[model samples]
Target: MRRHELPRTHAAGRTYLVTGSTSGIGYFIAEQLARTGAHVILTARTAGKAELAQRAIRHSWPQAQLSTLSLDLADLSSVRAAAGHLATFADRLDGVVLNAGVLAQQTRRETVDGHELVYGTNHLGHFAFAAQIYPLLQNTLDSRIVTMSSYAARWATLDLTDLESSRAPYRGFATYKRSKLAQTIFAFELDRRLRRGQSSVSSLLAHPGGALDALSPKRPPMPVATTAQVLRARPLSLIAQGKDKAAWSAVRAVLDPQAHGGQLWGPRFLRSKGEPRQERPTAAMTDRVVAEQLWQLSEDATGVKWPSLSQPRRL
Candidate 1:
């Protein structure tokens, strides 16, 4: 189908909360959604970025319904506060794009919540946020939860026994891969739970293949000074694709009628720069038993539980 032939989202009165909307692919997706008339809540760690992004969006779509919210996914308290704030502002949420995340940091650090920086920010935080906001989604007509994963997740091993990586030394890129794998596993697990309970909310996952966008702009610690050395070693612009393609994949997942629950979408070509295709999560990431275990672990770690579960375990 042609570019214009694809279904454009019509979200006149709907409300959407897109995490990490201040930059990169998240910003693109949130902007597109706001342009379509959705009351979009763009989240950032600081008020300045959020306000800056909101203003940029308004500059383009003058009448756009855009707002900003402070959310630090690495901190569970912040996640809870954001969820509560969203609940207070809107009775229901039509869609949520879990696009905010960090990349391979050179050093080993922990969030205020004490989770390994990569796994904490990439997976656990989002897990808590999603679980806390489960009710808001449940109240919507056809709510959707969209998570951003990565191709590196395929290389990961789900080491649930030591989820915090305290048992092993910090290996930057590998840890990132593990967290992404957790995301895929989390999405599958969430879908299974939703299916078992027959809930209307659906979970979907997507990946933005090697993009040149500054995915990790912050500096790494001295030990891992060459943290993003790989990017510098190669011509990133040549090897990496554009952010627009990733936005298309997200838009389709959020708006396409044919998009089914639990589906994973990515670029259609070898370089991840063409049309989007429906891809299944890797076997390691889709194991139902592992997913359930991860879900239980996440609940224990975050202290948030979905009420729709048949057995609501105390966190």
Candidate 2:
């Protein structure tokens, strides 16, 4: 479906924060929210990129309620500072899309904080940000936190003993898959905690299955089995959907009235390309023990702990 043909739920007066909104799927997600009358807080690593995103959104919808904030997900200090700035915005936030992430590189690297780059940016940064700004979401009525994962998560084998890949040999694709798995686990664990605490806030996960977009610079070679799976997929990766369609899973998780916490959404076909829908995730992706372990590791790594709530708050 075209961007215009996707569901555009009314979001007038609601405020949403989208990380990595300067380009690609993040940009499209922000644009869709802004077009529906939501006040979109678009984040970029630099002032120039943020300005460009704002201009693009305004050009498309002159009346768009938009703002910009600087965020570098690879840097913990920057993530904290950005969260602090966002906390000052108002009493509450209607939604937050944790969409910023780094693609797999040819070699392993570490973030400024000394963790693996992909793990730090894709999972830990968002983890810290979410913990800090969770109060805002809790106060907001029926608020949602939509985290972006990836199909690469299916290939992940998270080693609790070597969460940072320091003790094991590092492969770029494996590291990237680990980061996505961390995100998936985080989302599910968060939802479980929220429900256990009886909080109104919801946590949802979404993935842009095989969309050809800016963040994905090129396709990496797959194993024989994975390659066959892709080949059998409808439409194949040769003609995969664009970022806008890939972003719909996230948009739906964010705005669809039927969407609920703890659900994972992705494309409707072959886990590659199609419209957004609820999809079954791998068993490892939904493993509660793994999720709890990851939650603890995230807290330790980021030094940010989620606030404990005794009961659900009225919206």
Candidate 3:
């Protein structure tokens, strides 16, 4: 299928939570779900953005079932508060799109939690949110948690000793790559744990090929003309697709009935943009040792324990 012709999956009556849904790919994901008659819980960093998103969706689908939550993935407290608010909702979540993230910051910074801003917001924040709201996911049958990764993950070299980038010199791109790698690792590890516990909730990973925009304020500015020219000369630029096309991998990962735990989905033509399809993750992303270590580190860093699945709950 062409990029604009991506197929839709059945989602009527199901409730989905999509972080950073006020604009860009996350907005489209929420809109698509709402279009299919699903009740969409849209999250934003502020109430204003959330209101705009809701208005946009309502403009397109007057009767769309929608609710908004204020969440800042950079703030662990915000994530926890959002989870607490989410628990008050009347319906069980059918899925969650862990799509909030930062591309890269111009300078090294720290979150309020005192970790590298990029790593903390892109990976750790989502880690805590997913873990906290996991029981709600578990309560739903065949529910999914889709963690958004990036093409940069393959270039990352994770050092277990310095997951927070404390010991190493900070390079913006390197830090961002490691964060994406962490996301993929967490997704796969969560899948493994869920399987071990005999739970039905699936954990999936996806990357937007070259999609440029997301709702988060932390997104880096577009490259300058000279930089764009240099990038266009590189082979990777050939696969650079629009944001809408880039979101397909994530949309498919969430709604495709055939999609399963531990699968990595992205554009069909490797890094180049095309129809979404199952793709192999990097060796680092699939390494059991790396995944386990990252999981432990996430639990330690976030102070959120993974829920026990000894007794799987049916929706």
Best model number under lDDT:
2
TM-scores, one per candidate: 0.88, 0.89, 0.89
Pairing residues by index, what is the TM-score of model 1? Answer: 0.88
Residues 130-245 of candidate 1: C-alpha lDDT, one tens digit per residue: 88888878878678898888878878998889777776567888888889999989988888887887777888888877664543232121012243764573565454654545
Estimate the TM-score for candidate 3. 0.89
List where candidate 3 sits over 4 angstroms from the true fold.
1-4, 213-238
- Model 3 weakest 10-residue run by lDDT: 215-224
Model 3 per-residue lDDT tens digits across residues 1-315: 455565666677799999988877787778778877889999999887887788777877788999988899888999899999999974698899999888777678899889889999989999999988988989999899999888889889888888777754667888899999898888888888889998989999888877543211222122123555445545544656656577788888888888899999888876657788888887888899988888888889889888896577987
lDDT of each model, Cα atoms only?
Answer: 0.78, 0.83, 0.82
Question: Candidates 1 and 3: which is better by lDDT?
Answer: 3
Candidate 1 C-alpha error for residue 230, in Å: 17
